[model samples]
Target: MRFFALWNPFVFVGYDIASKQQIKETVRELYSSKPHLTATIGFSFAGLSAALSGAVWTGAVATLIVLACMMFRVWMEHHFRARSSEDVGEKWVRLFVFGSLLSGFGWGLSGALLLYGTSAETQAITMGIACAILQGAAGRAYMTPGTALINISLVIGQMSIGAFAEGNYIYVPAFLLYFTFLASFIQQMVDNRLRQLNAEQTAERLFREITEKNELLRIANERLATKAYEDPLTGLANRRKFDLALAESLAASNDTGSTISLMMIDVDHFKAFNDTYGHQSGDECLQLIARAIGSSLAGRDSLVARYGGEEFVVIVRGEAPDMAIAIAERICLAVRLTSLDSLPSAPPRQTISIGLVSSRAGTPETREAMLAAADAALYKAKKGGRNRVCVHRGPCPGQQQEQDTVVPFDAAKQA
Candidate 1:
């Protein structure tokens, strides 16, 4: 029976881990419906026994006592069901009154049978059946603790009657005491099991909640990290991330004797375009240009970042000066291919100028020097004409001028 009671494998641990208020509400629901069933069962069995036995007066008295006890039990159960924990003291008092009355009636029935000179066997059988019925009814009324107590009590009463029949009156009290203690022990075991089950369920629920919270937090952290390194408008690496990547690339090149190239690209006539087409359209143009530049150099070690308004930067690792210049030409061509008609009231065409610089193999230089060299080349490209690529070949310390230049791409020739 205990195994069956504890054998629910699918018990929800989450419910046990609920707040105190929630647990109380659930207990109330479970307890509220049980007492009525117990009361009905008690009254039905009492009526049946009264009709079965030939002792009409005893049967009638027993029936009345059971009916009164059932009424009191139902009333007290209902009262407790409706009452808060704070009000349970009075409700328990009522329950104790009903229990005492029932116990006293059992004692009276035993004495009355003894006084009437009834056969001990008949008295034992009748009282045993009555006790069994009452215990079964009690099992239906209370929870595990109360049910254990009631059943053990019934077992003790049955044994005491047998002892009395054997004329071992001295042993009867001891047997009763033994069963009473046994009932308490059983009740304690049941309570312990209940507590264990509740604890396991609560732990399972907490684990699930914690797992879900961690998953949510992980996703939130990822989004935050992405936003931190990414430019919101162009969806490219921001200046901070670009600078870090540049520094790392420079360090690796310095250590491994590899070459790194940098490109500074500025949209030609961007201020004019922004003036012709409002700031919103200017933003659209920048987005279009960013996409073109990003598509042109999709190498694993290449990085594109928006340096600021109307300016972008690209870092190319392990590339020669000619290869870097070629990539810049492709970017220039890609930008020209993209239609700028979408820009509101814009000219028929738009273009960008790129300045490319490669780091020397033996000479180590700061990031600022490399950027300055590229900017000088960019100034040369703008001075000659926009929409062209210029490579920086000047000495790092002085003399800023492009050693070589590529002509601006003609839109008509782009077929």
Candidate 2:
């Protein structure tokens, strides 16, 4: 009873590893045996059977059985290889198990046919050959322990039946003992392999988790970097980015002996506009004006930034004083024409005043001096009447007695 229980296919089904994993392992092991290798094994068994039994008929029958089994194995291997790993399941496993059974039956029948009417010495040699085949099957099929147990049982059963019918009861106990040891060895092998597979699966899962966390961290860093240098409200370069750009442009101007044009712009009566409408409308107005200014300067090599509340700044490199004035004029008209339909509670049109300063390469104008000059020009534009463009040509270090040359253009007069 214990001998039969040992060979039952369900004996190892309670292992921790999944049945699907076992199916994949079995298919992989089976396909690893190349067609030529299987052919060699089949021909060797047939050739040996004839040599030991001295019966060409038995060898011929063995050849037919081996060829039939080999062809089925080749077809099965092709079918498995063509399928995706995810698609492999119990149906395929059952098919493979059936094939293994067929193969074991064929080999066992070959052994029984070889043993029939043979001398006792020939019968002993035949049993030894059958044992060799059983050991080889166990090695090949141990990963799917159930399949291995089934094949071992079928092959050993036929071999034992042949020995008993030939009145060789003395060899029965030896076969039984050998079978016991082989079954124990197979069980140990299956346990070891399952442990290895479990370890590998755990390692793979950890690797994937680490990889996903790294990808998410990379994306968050990119967003943080962008926010560091960008204006959250307007999606424009903020003051920090503007400072860096101006410093780099100033260095480039020093090298190229070019002029650096700076424009400081302020929306006219913005405080009054905010007071008339709510803060929400003030935000909408600023967004609209920002879009107008950005559109006006499109395709120009320039950087525009919101300097502060109701104030914006622009830096244009390598342009003449007249070119700077033209750019300021464009900005004034663009802002004036800006549609306030999005802010229905606001006025029909809004206007801006721009203060321009052009610093030549050899000038000793520092960053602070240029900004002060632009601010003074903006003050001059307000004094000259709002909605005008003003340029400052004056000394860098402010002296109370030194009057700045203010060039102011009224948009209405120019029109």
Best prediction by TM-score:
2
lDDT of each: 0.64, 0.75
Q: For residues 320-356, what per-residue lDDT tens digits would candidate 2 score against the true structure?
A: 8788889899889988888887785746688889999
For candidate 2, the clash count comes to 0
Q: Give each model a TM-score.
A: 0.58, 0.69
TM-score of 1: 0.58
Range of the 10 consecutive residues with the lowest summed lDDT in candidate 1: 5-14
Scanning candidate 2 in windows of ten residues, the lowest lDDT window is 1-10
Expressed as tens digits, the lDDT of each residue in 1-415 for candidate 1 is: 2533422322222343455554455345433535434433543444344445544554455456545655655665577666655432334543543453454344334333321323444445444554554444334322334433443454455446645765658646775666555554454555555676578678988999999999999999999988998988999999988999899998998888788999899999989887878789989888999999999988647999999889899999998867877788888889988898877775556688888788888667668888887888888788877788877775553435444433333322442
Clashing residue pairs for model 2: none
